[model samples]
Target: MKNAPTATNSQSTKNNQLEQSQYNTESLTDLSTAAQRARVLHYLQNHRALTTLEARHLLNVMHPAARVMELRDHGYKIITNWRQDSDSAGRLHRVAEYVLMAGGDA
Candidate 1:
């Protein structure tokens, strides 16, 4: 008879994912701290002024605070602003947005 797949197989597969939060911490911090700055002279080049979730998904860094700190320390001026919601004040956990400061180098 053929052997059936086991739960252990599923567990092992999850453990092997490099992009997941656990395995990514150290590796991401290394990569994150390395790509600390880049040229963004135009709208298209901006990193979407990415939201925290987008950062986690795209950058492999779960903690947006850590990534923001690393970027700022490298001389990129991060300007924050409050974007008002249309419906209600309690609609979202975060209302703040960021843009690189004026006169910033590419």
Candidate 2:
């Protein structure tokens, strides 16, 4: 009976690992806050809009709202709009979609 519990725990641990691996958090942590800000700004400048999911997956930014806040503090004009997006598990989540209205002094 104890062996069955151990097997279940092992499988649970593996599932947790798999979920963490899907996000690639290691690469996100490798980027400095300034670098992450720069990437977010550049992407916004070209694309004009960025979603939280896009920032995480494409720009490797873990906390995009933090980066956007930093940019706003630097005088950048950014606006946040909420939208419903589906996650990998197909659950709907209200995510922030940021739009850059103007550039600030660097």
Candidate 3:
């Protein structure tokens, strides 16, 4: 005999799937604030610019603006450009694109 799936179980499964699809677990598994800031800075150095979506999906930083602000406070020159982008869930949003103008203190 086998037990059938309940509504709660099905809903939980859907939520899990949604969460998995929304975030890159491999990149986000373990990262501290400093690590995320470093990653974002390195990425900006190589890429010259980074969008909010890129920060979230590629760098695994949930709050890119906060990281950017920290970098700015550290004397890094960063500029923000607004643009519309679609998230993992295909929802349109006005996201900030941060462009690195100059490097600051180490």
Q: Per-residue lDDT for 2-42 in model 2, tens only? A: 22235546655543433344345334465866667777877
- Candidate 3 per-residue lDDT over residues 1-106, each given as its tens digit: 0132456565455334323433443345557665677777778878889999999999889999998886675556889999999998999999999998854322
- List the global CA lDDT of all models: 0.42, 0.72, 0.73
Number of the candidate with higher TM-score, 1 or 2: 2
lDDT of 1 by residue, 80-104 (tens): 6666533233455554455666654
The residue pairs found clashing in candidate 1 are: 39-106
Q: What is the lDDT of candidate 1?
A: 0.42
Q: Write down the TM-score of every candidate.
A: 0.43, 0.66, 0.67
- What range of 10 consecutive residues in model 1 has the weakest lDDT sum? 35-44
- State the lDDT at 53 in candidate 3: 96
In TM-score terms, candidate 1 sits at 0.43
Poorly placed runs, candidate 1 (over 4 Å)? 1-32, 35-45, 82-91
